[model samples]
Target: MVTIKDIAARLEVSASTVGRALADDPRISAAMKQKVQEVANDMGYVVNRAARMMRGVSSNLVGLVVPDIRNSFYSTIAHALSKCLESADLQLTLSETDDDRLVELRHIRELTSVNVAGIIIVPTARPHPESVRLLKMTSCIQLLRRHASLGEHWFGIDDTQALFQATRHLVELGHQRIAYIGGTTDLPTGAARLQGFHGAVAGSKAAAHVREELGAPASTDFGRDAIRRLLALRSPPTAVVLGSVQNTQGALEELHASGVSVPETLSVVGFGDELGFRWWGPGLTTISLPVSELATACGLWFIHQLKQKSANPAPYSSVSPPTLVVRGSTRAVEAANASRAPARSRQLAG
Candidate 1:
C-alpha cells in the first residue's frame, strides 16, 4: 500500500518529484531518479497502473481470453503467447470464459475498463454483439475460433482442412466404414469440420460409408457416448476419425475400457497431437497443428502493432496448415479379413 507520499516522506522530497522520478521524466536528475527509485523499491511502493492509465499512459498489460484451459491446446498457446509478449516487455492477463457469451462479455468489459494494451481471445463460437462492439473499438486479436462479427483480426488453423486430411488418410488406408465424432454444427468450427469430412467422403473413389455423431458443446462424455453408439451399430466403423481433443480422449478411453485393440481391431485417428497421445495404447495417428507457432506469430504481430501505436491496425488473418502424423493407431484394410467387420464392442450404443 506504499504510495508517492510515503516515498516522498522517506526522501524528504515533494510528491510531484517522486512521481516524475518514478516515471523517469527528463525533468528529474539521474541522481534524484535513482534516489527516489531506490527508496520506492525499499518501501515496497508499486506503480498504480490504473492511475497512470487515467493520465493517458498506455498499459503494458495485455489480455488473453480462452474458453477452456484443461485442454493442453489452450495452455500451449498461453505459454507461447506469454513468452513472446514477455520478450516485448508486455505482460499477459488471462481469463477463462467457459465458452459462455455472458462471461465473455463481462471479461471484455473489465479488460477495456482498465484500458489494457490489447486483447487476444479464442472467442466463443458466437460472440456477444456487445463484446464484438467493444472489441471493434480496441486493439483486439481473435485466436483459434473467430466470430464473423469480429472481422479478420484472427489467426487459426483450417478446421475443415484438418478434418478433411484426417478422413482422407483413413480412406487412403482402404477403410470403407469410417465414423466421425465431433461438435455440433451450431459451432462454426464444427460445421466446417463436418463439411471437410463429408467433402472427403464425397470425393473419394472408394465406397466410403460415413457415420457422423455430433453433439453440442462436445466434451469427453459426449465423445464416449458417441463412440459407444457408433460401436453398437449393426455395421460399426472399421476406423474412427476424432474431430476434437475431447472426442479423441473419450473415444480412446472407451476403446481401452472395451478391450478393443487399436489398428488390429479398430483403427483410430485423433485430432490434436497432444504429448500423451503418442503413448496412448498404440501411438495415435493424429492431425498435428502448429498451435505454438501460430500463437507466437500472432503475439509478435500484436506487439509490432502495439509498438507502432496503430489505433486501427489493418485487418490481417493467417491460416496454418495441419499435418497428418501417421502412427501405430491406424492400419491398411488389406491386412484384415475381407468381411471388414469392426472388432469393437457391439453391445453398447451412443
Candidate 2:
C-alpha cells in the first residue's frame, strides 16, 4: 500500500506537491506533474478512492444498466461501451434489470448512491419515478430504449426505418401477405418498429395482407410462440419480419422445429445481424445495426458531458441508420421472379 508520502519521499517533494500532481491540479507545473506521475506509477501508489468518495468526489467508474446480456444486441453494446471507456482509464460497472421496473429502480439507486462518474442505461418500458429522478441528478445517457419520463439525452437507431425497410423488401419481392413478430408498444423501440412495419405494408402500391403477433417483454419464448400462432393461420404469410433480436432468435428456433423450410416455405427477415444469423438456414436476411458504433459514440459523448461538468443545455439525441443486408434466406416469389430485379442484391454468405 504505497502512499502519497512514499512517492513524495522518493521524488524529494512534499506530500502536498505529490497529491496535487497526482490530481492533475493546474497549480503544479507540467514537468513536475510528469515526474510525479512517472514515479507514482512505478511505485504503484494507488489513489485513496474511499477518501475521495467521502469528500464527495466520484469514483473512476462508470455504470451501465441494461436488460439481459444474452441478447446479442445488448451484449454487443456492452462490449463496445467497455472498450470505449478503457481508453479513458476508466472502468465500467454493468447491471441488468431484466426489464422489471423494481429491478431497474434498485440498480439506479445503488449506482447513484455510489457517486459514479455517469450512468448509461437502456431504460425499461416504464421506469419507476424515483429511478427517473435519480438519473436526472447525474450525468446519464439512455441507449436504444427511451421513456417519456426521461429527457432526450440518448443514442439510438431509427427503429421505424429499420422495420419499414425489412417489411417493404418482402413486399417488393411479390409477397403480399406478411407476418410481423415484435415487442409491445410500451417501449420506444417497439412502438417505432411496429409503426415502420405497418407503414411499409399500408403505404405499398400493391394490396398487402398482414398479420402481426406483438406483446410484452420481447423474449425468445414470445418470439417462438408468435411464429407458432402465425403458422397456424389459415392463409400463412409468405414472408415474416422479426422486429426484435430476442424475438428473432425465438422465431428462428420455432421455424426450425416446425420443419418449415426458409425461403422455400417462408422467407424471414431478422432484427440484428448476430453472428449466428449468417449460419442459419440459407443465411438469414436481416437488418444490420451498427451496435458497436452507436455504443462507442454514446460513450464518447458521455465522456464529453462529464468533462463539461453537465449535460448540454439542450438535450442531445443521436440516431444511427440501420442497413438492410440481403442474403439467400430471402428470394423472389414466382410472380416476382421475372417481374423485376430483387429489392436488394448485396448478398453475404455464411
| Model 2 lDDT tens row, 1-350 | 99999999998989999999989899999999999989988998789988888889898889999989888888888899999988887789999998998999999988888789988999888898999899888888889988767888889999999999998899888787788999889888989999999888886633457888998888999999999888888977778999989899999888877777677677899999988998987889999999999999998987777777754446889999999999977877674345334422323232
Reference-based TM-score, model 2: 0.91
Q: Write the per-residue lDDT of candidate 1 for residues 267-287, one digit (tens) a residue.
A: 899999988899887689999
Measured over all alpha carbons after superposition, the RMSD of each candidate to the real structure, in angstroms, is 3.3, 4.2
Estimated TM-score for each candidate? 0.89, 0.91
Supply the TM-score for candidate 1.
0.89
**lDDT against the true structure, each candidate:** 0.87, 0.86
Which regions of candidate 1 deviate over 4 angstroms?
5-18, 24-36, 205-208, 338-350
Q: What does the lDDT come to for candidate 1?
A: 0.87
Residue 244 CA displacement from its true place in model 2, Å:
1.0
